[model samples]
Target: MQHHRGRTRIVGALSVVVATLAATLVPTVAANAITGADFDPGHIISDLQFYDNAAMSEAEIQSFLEARVAPTGCVTSNCLAAFKMDTFTRAADRNICTEYTGGSQESAARIIYKVQRACGISARVLLVTLQKEQSLLTATAPTSWQMTASMGYGCPDTAPCDAQFYGFYNQVYKAAWQFKRYSTPDPWGTYQPGNRYIQYNPNPDCGGSWVNIRNNATAALYNYTPYQPNAASLANLYGSGGSCGAHGNRNFWTYYHGWFGDPEYGGLPGVTVTRFDVANRYESSTRISQEAFPSAPVPVVYLATGHNYPDALTAGAAAARQGGPLLLIDGASIRPVVDAELKRLRPQRIVVVGGPESVPESVVQALSAYSPSVTRVGGADRYEVSRSLALTMNPQGPVNEVFVATGSNYPDALGAGMAAGYRKVPIVLVPGTDTALDAATADFIRRLAPQKITIVGGPVSVSPGVEAQLKTFAATTRVNGANRYEVSTNLARNLYATQRPTTVYLATGLTYPDALAGSVLAARKSAALLVSHPYCIHPSTLSAITDFKVNSVTLLGGPVSLAANVKYMVRCW
Candidate 1:
């Protein structure tokens, strides 16, 4: 069955609309950048954004039309602003659509609202479609052809406009009806919400790509237009893209964003965000560990001090290599809850990281009650502990690689931990103040003889002198940013963006417990861990979703770790 897209371009049509807009209307303020790559062929616009009936009231629609043209500008009497028609009532189509009321001597705005109320299609969509099809909204001299083919309802490319559908009320009703009609179970359109090959131009010779259409709104737009803009058209959004360009859907997105706002931004929209949290950070670890090891026996469980986060960074990497969970415990003695969890996990051995000073000898002895074998990997300081764990975790010589970060802070190393945990390697902590890489840290890495070493922060955190020293050990790559936020995004891009993982773990960048625990969970889930401000999500963090093509985010902790408002920001911003 053949159906019509909204309309093909008529020369000087959109230019008139653009000029009218620049002269009278306020310029469009878009929240996100309009780039070709960010264009989700699958999700051009969300269903909620498309079917919103109350998107505009009668007054707002009238105001929009009035602003575009003036009384003196009109060469004819029957302009869109002054157009009036008698609208008939529409019956409900069961689950397909709702009913619309009829009216006599109704204004164009009133007709649009009634039709929208009946069909559940947005008035904004109707308004934009008017201009996109015939420049009806801004034309000073409204031609008979423009008014008759107002919404471009039944005007197929190879045939003349059907006389029966040639009226203001007729076109608006038919267009809105067609949009809702395309959503039915036995929809009468070629395109639909799935993998589809959409053409760049009507001429099949121009070629196209397989687009994963996400919803009815996007599919409806394609069914109406039947073509996507080529790279040349996308490259020149405001103007022309030579002969291959198609402007129907492109103008629809542009007009909506410019006049109203982000088509998908009225509510918390785009992607799904799931939360994984509990009373405290300790539970977050145990829960994730249980998820990773559901219905299976654990070989080992690693313990690190809850008070300090540095040791856990390296310990996490080692624990991951051994298919174990890194549990946080009090420095003086293990918590009763942790002890209880230990009994439940029932590991063959318990490996306690850091020296007795960090985890007292009494605690080590107490751990033995749960597991017959209790091993202690102690070092004089955090740096030493990081090195010790790297070697102990990998009995095999020349492991894949290791991550090196400053011991002074946890942010850089936190990112390093995720990569290491995922790769089942190690993360070594180096003293940032040391002008040269310490012999101890350097020598421990030399023994591992990794193929590569990634420095997690800039010179301030891990100085250039140290980076040079590590190069001697293996091929060296550095992941850094102006602040911790940039480092996290860069690491996420480097690690997981290639495969385009939709799901990722988000933790507050201000602290370490949630991210520390979440890193292992991310590794277990085969995802990346990202950090941001506790309340307002960072710009970089939000933009990363579009750049990386991530459609799902899992926040690791409760409001205590990341505030409730952060959830809203992740989607809207």
Candidate 2:
């Protein structure tokens, strides 16, 4: 039941004293691009948006409330930030929410967590609803009535507040239950995820418009509110609206966008993809490394800074040649998680790539505890580092094969890293923008005197002059395509020319960290490392999947880096 304007609508839709407080909820840097005009009445949010209970922990929820309701300005101890209540247990309901195991003297955050976990609704949604429905989020001195109708669960425009759902805990629980109920089988019969004519207001004359609801969660939102905002409401979302306007649904969109991110899942559902991820890039590297080398003590481990990308791929290549894992770090100190991984790997020797600036002496000294022999291989910059690393990889002359790629960017060079490792050769780096090969790389190429030279990437990545310079030294050729994804497929296609590879590593082309580290794992497994769009695998990558007869694909990063949607469509192509 919504209280619009003078009716029991979304009261805060009109500007009040809490405007300053409302602004703080939307972070400036995280400012959502969606505007009021972009509001979709049918698809209010996604199933993932509504059901991701892990979106916020109890501590995070408490912090959010504390940030919203500043204690010094608060006149009432009854604010959500300071409020606490004894909570009870709830039984599991498949159609609605799971059983909530409540406890005595529960804080607002705790109660919210229980309800969120049990009902499988995001606590973020619960927080936004509190702010939208009653401004309870920033309420300095709310009346007993405000908390009573906290979520406006049983408060309809035509009737007074229901006494049974009076308290904050009760309101939160019942509201979560009701929303979950709407998502169940045979949901509110009138509203499913399709076209539906929802009214603008309680007034019969207000009429309705057709909205194609996206999912069950969206359907649940419509069934709960039962009214759509008129054009006037969308025109001025932050404030009040026209005569026939309803702000319940409008405020829902604005609050959600401002507080959380865009709740819309414009993409498809998640495909079953094995995401080798933890908290961040460093952990993701370790997770991927662990997957490649389940147990350790076999040989050596390559250490590189997760912050610096230039040396990571070469390090991965070198590590693969030695049959080891490439681990990423902060360069300054060893993370407890990294330390744990090192202790598990129990490498005979740890090789630190890059100069002191990249992996300083302190980190090297600290790393000595994990391995008996620790060595450092680096030079002035990434180009020198790559040269020195390549030389270190093969100290002897007559280096059988050589691969060259741009140091300026990562994607084109990503597939080359695995190819170099597969042949146990060095992958050298040169500045891509340069017209010709630099003296150091030329001298290194002369020293190696390779039988075959394969320049990975298009002319943009490796210049024609550089290719010509390489041809002077040996039989130089190129494996390239229009884009990073195509280049990746071309390199993989060249590697497994005679046989189909069994494994493939899929990493996001939008970023380089995961691909940089995953390259080694792919090489170790004799698999292809394909660059992909965050949301979907490229056409070339899909074709490569089929051509190579890849039975497994390990997605390198988390959902944000490479969306699960891409994983679902991998089999399609």
Candidate 3:
């Protein structure tokens, strides 16, 4: 059963005459007092069948009554006496035996009396018909009436007696309303209201026998004296007496139920209240997730540099030969060396990788002559070179191809190539210290294939055999020397100026992670820096310098910078 709080009704003031009449009636008259119309005397009589069958004792009845009654504020001895009389009168009606077939009827009468005295309507008005049908005490013989009572209907002992059943709480509410309808017309009226009467006789044609039964039922229930009719008193009566009162004693009845059950009762609609509570519970239990990208089809590119042309070769290789139509360049200027390699391997772009001082006037002049498309990019003091062999490469887009410039004289190219791959840019490393063709270079040529390889460094480390293996892969070969800072700065300037896939490799000895981090910080664009020694600075300092756009910082090895650079790069990424 879905439990809910029910509504409440208020009683009005009582008149002096009614109070006087109620006071004179004592035990015999009190049982007939009116409480309300819906009290169902017939149902009461029926329910009492269980009590009559010895199922419930007198003590239990008294206890039930006491538990259900609300305390009345009436302090006068007369009022107290009247109240006691009414209680006894109802008890007697409920306790009728064989010596009194009508005893149960008397008990029904007394109940109505107390209800009317205490609540203000006759028992008939309260619908207490059960009192007429069954005795309050146990019956020795089983009867159809008892069966009907058990089924919630109170059937009178006489012919044409039909069963009438009403739940206990529902009766109380009906009784309260009956009292209200009766009281409103003449606030002090002792007579039952004609408008609220019900004809219960099956043979209504028999001079309205049902009306007499109803009248007698009314008299038996509400025998109380009427006084000032108070709505508060009535509310207390309805809230405290009858089935609602009994349920209240059991702690089951609540105000919400009454409000919805009774049209006159007050409260918000039941369904709405329930829904509000459910919604609150749902909101408390759930959460939501969000996606990183809402749009699509944007390009992402990575650039790398070669050993000799550390920065340029890496960038060029990333942009051209490794991918597609995009351009890559190697900035190193060993043109004869790079051109021969370029002719043999044919990289899509050539970026001359070098330090700040590496771009000499002569080399620049040669580049101007050979590939005027080669553009100087980055800051004035430190710039790298971007040689667009063909199509212009956009640094911001995704990288697909790679180009490489190699030479035997510069062992840095191998490190540059590895660094490029770390940046997700694929590359080819070329070998040759000069523009010469040698078997050693040929061996280097053999080693530079399908991507992965290790180039061990040593004093005077350009292994000719390694150069030969590198030649097999060298798309372009360039040679030049410049300070690490100049190379980095030039790379940054050129990247900003041309906005192409570019790389700047710092010269071995001069490049420091700290200085490179600082340059990166200063140039907040998309330029990639290839620092040979990332360990020259503390990890914390490097962290702060490369905090933004950290993806652009690539580490190359320096003699003293190896361990720290390795540690920082491994952890930071």
- The best candidate in terms of TM-score: 2
Off by over 4 Å in 2: 1-49, 52-270, 273-277, 391-401, 409-415, 418-425, 446-451, 458-460, 474-512, 524-573
> Candidate 1 residues 1-573, lDDT tens each?
547546655222335544343343343332554655555556767676677655556776777787777656556667767777777877886665577677888998898877877787878789889987877888866888888888888877657777788888888877887887788878768988889999877768878889999789999988888888778766766555556666678767776666655565422346666566455777777776776677545889998888887667787778888888888887777776677678888998889988876788888988889898999998788888888888777877788888888999999988888888888888889997688887777778888999988889999998888888888889999998988988998988888746875476788898887787677777877887888777556778877766666677777776567643355453323
Reference-based TM-score, model 1: 0.54
- TM-scores of the models, in the order given: 0.54, 0.62, 0.18
Candidate 1, position 318, lDDT: 82
Candidate 3 residue 572 Cα shift, in angstroms, is: 20
Q: What's the count of clashing pairs in each model shown?
A: 2, 5, 152
Kindly report which residue pairs in candidate 1 clash with one another.
Answer: 5-224, 42-214
lDDT of 3 by residue, 469-514 (tens): 4445543232223533233333333334434423222223343222
Global lDDT scores for all candidate models: 0.76, 0.76, 0.27
Q: What is the per-residue lDDT of model 2 for residues 1-573, given as tens digits with 9 covering 90 to 100?
A: 332111235333344422443465564123346666788776787776676654566776888788776645567768888888888877887677888887888998999977987887878788877876778877767789778778888776667767777788989998888777777775653578888888887776978888888788877777667788887767766655566766766677777767655667432333223556445788888888887899767598899888867877677778888888888888698888888889998999999998888888999998888988999998888899888888768888778889999999878777788788877899999997788988988898899989999999988888898898889999989998988888888888999899877677888887777887887778777778788877556778878876766666667876567653454442213
